[model samples]
Target: MIKAKQIVKKFESGTNVLFAVNHVDLIVPKGQFITITGRSGSGKSTLLYQLGLLDKPTSGDIELAGRDVINMSEDERTFYRLSKLGYVFQDYAILPSLTALENVLLPLLMLGLPDADARRMATDAMVRVGLEDKLINYPSQLSGGQQQRVAIARAIAHDPEILFADEPTANLDTETSDMILELFLKLHKEGQTIVMVTHEKDYAEKADRIIELADGKIVRDETLRRN
Candidate 1:
């Protein structure tokens, strides 16, 4: 569902150019669970941002569901991102003042859905993440795991074709991380496409395929047999 060819992303601070993602080529098939693994400064997050269209690449191309991103207009890019891509971040990017249900419904609001339908979808998503009881809870009231689950619910509430997770388990305990992984696997089995960035080897091993990066380049690509 996503492809990148010789993608390069660089940042200029004064006179120095730092290549965060250097000539990285990646392909993630539909309905597949793929993990991107790397150390700090290895370009994993940059690559994810590029794939999600949160950041523009300096060079090369990104194709999502067959359309080249570089060819899209600014408004088209925004619409595409709003309707087709879902993002989950390590820091649990839930709105501090909004309750869990409201946060999940935010994407639907962006789509201009009616309030009733938005609430229905948001409730379903929260239930999917086992957070139905926390619907009225704000970010400050939920634990890290609960907050991350809320983020996941919000990300997928729109039923995006692709889900992008950056360091999804970074802040959760091992048990909670395992539960989240199980939820991801369940979604994957039901044909949800996922691209997750993770530092934990155990989580990486659970994916159908693992892509490792170092020094802004892919160092290893392996398909793991399901046990």
Candidate 2:
């Protein structure tokens, strides 16, 4: 779960201040699948970065599962991010030299889990993403969708409480994109809390909630009913 209040992320552009995210307040409950959508410069990805703890807001408060995270030390933030959050980006972000299983296990190893434990978790995560057969393959050997699945596996290896994805299917073909979305839906049905930023309206509509942003502000926040 996340709660943000009056989040302002401003940048100095020459003499003018550009507000990428201006006074945005957002709440994402546990087990919810939410999509943030907007045109270029609309601040959807900027908002996601703030919520994902990848960047700090210039002025605002963010609570992640009830802990105040905005003021945490960098070291503390790193540990918390490793422990509680998972992330996927438009780029696969997979290491080129590492095998799929190795990539998935590295984060768990970084978390200080024993090798055996990390290995087990990593394999399970790969399986969850339908990549069990491709564990030994490197990013170069896999298809774009498979590589993305490996990235997802890496993110979920530690069983993170929140998964943040930014244009996760941007590089894939339509069929592959649909495959990724279906995987996300399956995970959500099993209680994963996902917050994804996408420019595609069809993908956004599949979520439990859709948030539309314009010029750094929320213009439409709609919660869709699931069957």
Q: Pick the candidate with the highest TM-score.
A: 2
lDDT of 1 by residue, 1-227 (tens): 89899999999999999989999988888888999998988999999999999989999899999888877888998999889999999999999989999999988999999999999999999999999899999899999999999999999999999999999999999999999999899888878999999999999989999999998899999988542
Best-performing candidate as measured by lDDT: 2
Task: Show where candidate 1 strays beyond 4 Å.
Answer: none
Q: List the residue pairs that clash in candidate 2.
A: none
Give candidate 1's root-mean-square deviation (CA, Å). 1.5
TM-score of each: 0.96, 0.98
In model 1, pairs of residues that clash are: none
lDDT of 1 at 82: 88
The C-alpha local distance difference test score for the whole of candidate 1 amounts to 0.92
